[model samples]
Target: MAEGGKGSRSGSDSDDQSAVETNLTATVNKVDGLEVQLVLQVRGLKPKGGLRSFLSKFSNHDNPTDLCANAEFTKWDVTSSSLSIEICVHTEKERKKKKGKHDVNTVNTETFTYKISNFPSEIRPEKTTLEIKQPPGETSYSFIVLTLQRVDKSVSWENFRTPRNS
Candidate 1:
């Protein structure tokens, strides 16, 4: 009977983990030229007493996705348009330096932001790709392949300099 109970508990934990993964998948959208936003809602992760507090030390809800963007600079003729991307983090940090007040570990109850810019304009169409790699020891990743239609709106922020034949 004890073995059965342990198996059931493990199954339940697996279900919880699957739910957490489903919640983490974010939707990406273009907020403006050279800017995009990844949006998601996260909740319901409570570890045991001391473990909860201990694990919170490594949690960074802001920019949890660790999003990164890339483009081919050799295929297209790009002008200097100051291309850039930004991420906004809405969580508050625990101020350990302040005295008397207890430090509060913030959760992912808010949105986070990240930004990257100064992309070269000489991007080409040599199979440009955008990938979001998972953190170390993780098994999942999100990927998007470049196509003409996807590039049309994505490369609209700046003018591209057409590639020169070799």
Candidate 2:
């Protein structure tokens, strides 16, 4: 249940789903303990195949045609059993002339959450992808892509934290 928070996922460990070992990467802009940038490959945006791919089309109307643009990881929390990934997407930004300075700002954030667990990652990389799996009772191979998943070491932080002022 990775894309746009649709579908239920099986906690059962099985190999029926297609496993694509993809190495994930992100753009780390601000590291005051929050806001990690995710560089989404446009190709990955398209579902691997099947019903999920068909459903993906309808779910992305409000979002940009290209899902990778201006993407960031707003939340990265890990526990003993699972890792929580919350990514937010923004539309193209506009620069406004404020006094003598020009400031770039964009709004209208769309978020998608994914849970990373159950299926074990054979190896750990700096950055990694969340597997998109069909929930229990759905066809076994509808939509499944095993992507590399792990936060890059460069974006170091002791624990998940929000803006200090917040």
Report each candidate's C-alpha RMSD, comma-separated, in the order given: 18.6, 19.2
Identify the runs in model 1 with alpha carbons over 4 angstroms from their true place: 1-82, 90-121, 124-128, 138-166
Best by the TM-score measure: 2
Q: Which lDDT tens digits does candidate 1 get at residues 52-125?
A: 43564465423222322211111122123222222222222344545876654442221111112233332332
lDDT over C-alpha atoms for residue 23 of model 1: 13
TM-score of 2: 0.28
What digit string (tens of lDDT, one per residue) describes model 2 on residues 1-166?
1112222222212212222222222222233322232222211232235664466646633222222334455556544334455554443334556798755443433444455452221224333334333345543222223233333444343333222111
Candidate 2: the clashing residue pairs are 8-135, 22-148, 128-148, 128-149, 128-150, 129-148, 129-149
Q: Which 10-residue window in model 1 sums to the lowest lDDT?
A: 1-10
What is the RMSD, in Å, between candidate 2 and the native fold over all Cα? 19.2
Candidate 2, lDDT over the whole model: 0.35
Off by over 4 Å in 2: 1-3, 6-68, 77-81, 92-106, 120-146, 149-166
- What's the lDDT for all of these models? 0.26, 0.35
